[model samples]
Target: MPFKKLHTNILERLERKDITTPTPFQSRSIPVIKSGANVFCAAPKDSGKTTTLILTTLHKLKCEAVGNAPRAVVLVENKEKALELYQAFLTYTKYNSLRVYVGYEELHIDIQKSEIFEGVDILISTPKTMNKLFLLNGVSTSQLKIFSIDDAGFLIQKSDSSAIISITQSIQKCQYVLYSEELHPKLKRFESYFMEHSKIIQI
Candidate 1:
């Protein structure tokens, strides 16, 4: 199916970077994504999962104004991955007025307990640190629209299920988008929790 028409602002931002064509994964998944369904995309590395996630999130952000703080959270594996994801989001949504924040264990001091989420629209961070922040009331999932887990297999393999469970339970009603190069055994164990009616795109 053709991708549902994205918001004009999102289309403009995508075009600004010459991103006019959807990757195979995007083409197959965008339609379901527009319907607000949970998606699980398992593709080899460099299949454009990051771009798909960022673009979808940007489209959503453009479709509606974010609340007082971030309404989307992206749980990654480590500091390096967090930074990489943050940079990608900035590049795609640079033309739009969206507040993006990156939180990691090393940057705990820089994140204020009370106002860490103030003015933030998207968060990219490790599950452990994000869970801590959520527990400390640094962020809330009540208004969240998107909950993504990039490199999801890695997070599950690292035995970070506790944090993942916490985050998922908190945002139970939010649309979930999970991406991974390969599904690990541990991740397969959580299939019931993350894969209900989820569309799996294998590239």
Candidate 2:
């Protein structure tokens, strides 16, 4: 009940995990996200930012249903984070009948050419893998809705940031959400370019 206005199905999923109250970060940031605005979230680690992003993304996409195209693209630093976030999405979308996909760097040769993103609602991957997938015509961002960057500070420091730029450039209608434990000047530059009239929430 505390996570008011969240989808009933989402609440049901959270109920299974005995999660009834929104985290401090979630309480402040989720409302901004539900307004369909670009969001820059500054929160400490283990503050539930990931869960907030996943739940709000699921809700946003559900409000306007989706086809086979990938609607949400999440960029993280590595495959481990991708897999972890993919699992988080699985929890939120448990009853929503959505597909979640994670790209693997090792398979960039054998399967990246084809099987990387068969059909996905939410896509989680490292930037280079996504760049490669795009180069090989394995994926498209023509219908993207949410372009999320978790651990923005780390990801922006890498050369693979170029890959993220390329992908975001292709997005037609999308909401950008960047979350980081700390923000530096370089990351702030990214925030300025990616988000327009965004709501900044620090917790």
Candidate 3:
């Protein structure tokens, strides 16, 4: 079953998808997230890390009634990965009022307009696209409370450290979650920046 701590509505939605038991990562990280702590986790792909990310993020938004303007920003490696995460996010928040925007390069420059960001509670994007959004969107991330990097190893490999820091530094007093399929030496600097004194979960 989904953890008793999770929202009932989410459990019902998961039930519709035949998702009952929590994966080890899901179980271990959910409570840590519930406590609003920073997390650096390593788990294999398709090990339900995305599900945990969705659940924790959705639950937090649902509980706190945070105002719009993309309170949570999840950084993936590319447009394809952003779309994939957006799909899963939609599946989990289907019954909720949350809005998710995918910031890919293919999208027209019109996104710089404020109308494009209306009611947007979560943002899924690449590091480059995120940087551009910050420059052009005129959107305020002051209310953002969750910053997630889905493929930290890959991001480090691409030398996206500066772009990542720029976004994280803009937000204050938010929870951070970093997950990677494999850990590399390059990821150490990324870990230290956000997960300082935070818990580490390895699977």
Give the alpha-carbon lDDT of every model: 0.76, 0.78, 0.77
- Which candidate, 1 or 3, has the higher TM-score? 3
lDDT for each residue of candidate 1 in 139-168, tens digit (9 for 90 to 100): 777778888888887765555887887767
Q: Which stretches of candidate 2 lie over 4 Å from their true place?
A: 63-65
Question: What is the TM-score (0 to 1) of candidate 2?
Answer: 0.90
Candidate 1 residue 52 Cα shift, in angstroms, is 0.1
lDDT digits (tens) for residues 1-203 of candidate 2: 33768877777788899988888888888888888898889999999988888888888777334676778888888888888888877767666677787886865444754553456777788888888777767777777878888888776555866777776666677899989997656666765456777778898
Q: What TM-score does prediction 1 earn?
A: 0.89
Backbone clash tally for model 2?
Answer: 0
Candidate 1 Cα outliers beyond 4 Å, as residue runs: 1-4, 63-65, 109-115
Q: Which is superior by lDDT, 2 or 3?
A: 2
**After TM-score superposition, what is the CA distance of residue 41 in candidate 2 from its true location, in Å?**
0.4
Which RMSD values do the candidates have, in order? 2.1, 2.1, 2.0
Q: Choose 1 or 2, whichever is better by TM-score.
A: 2
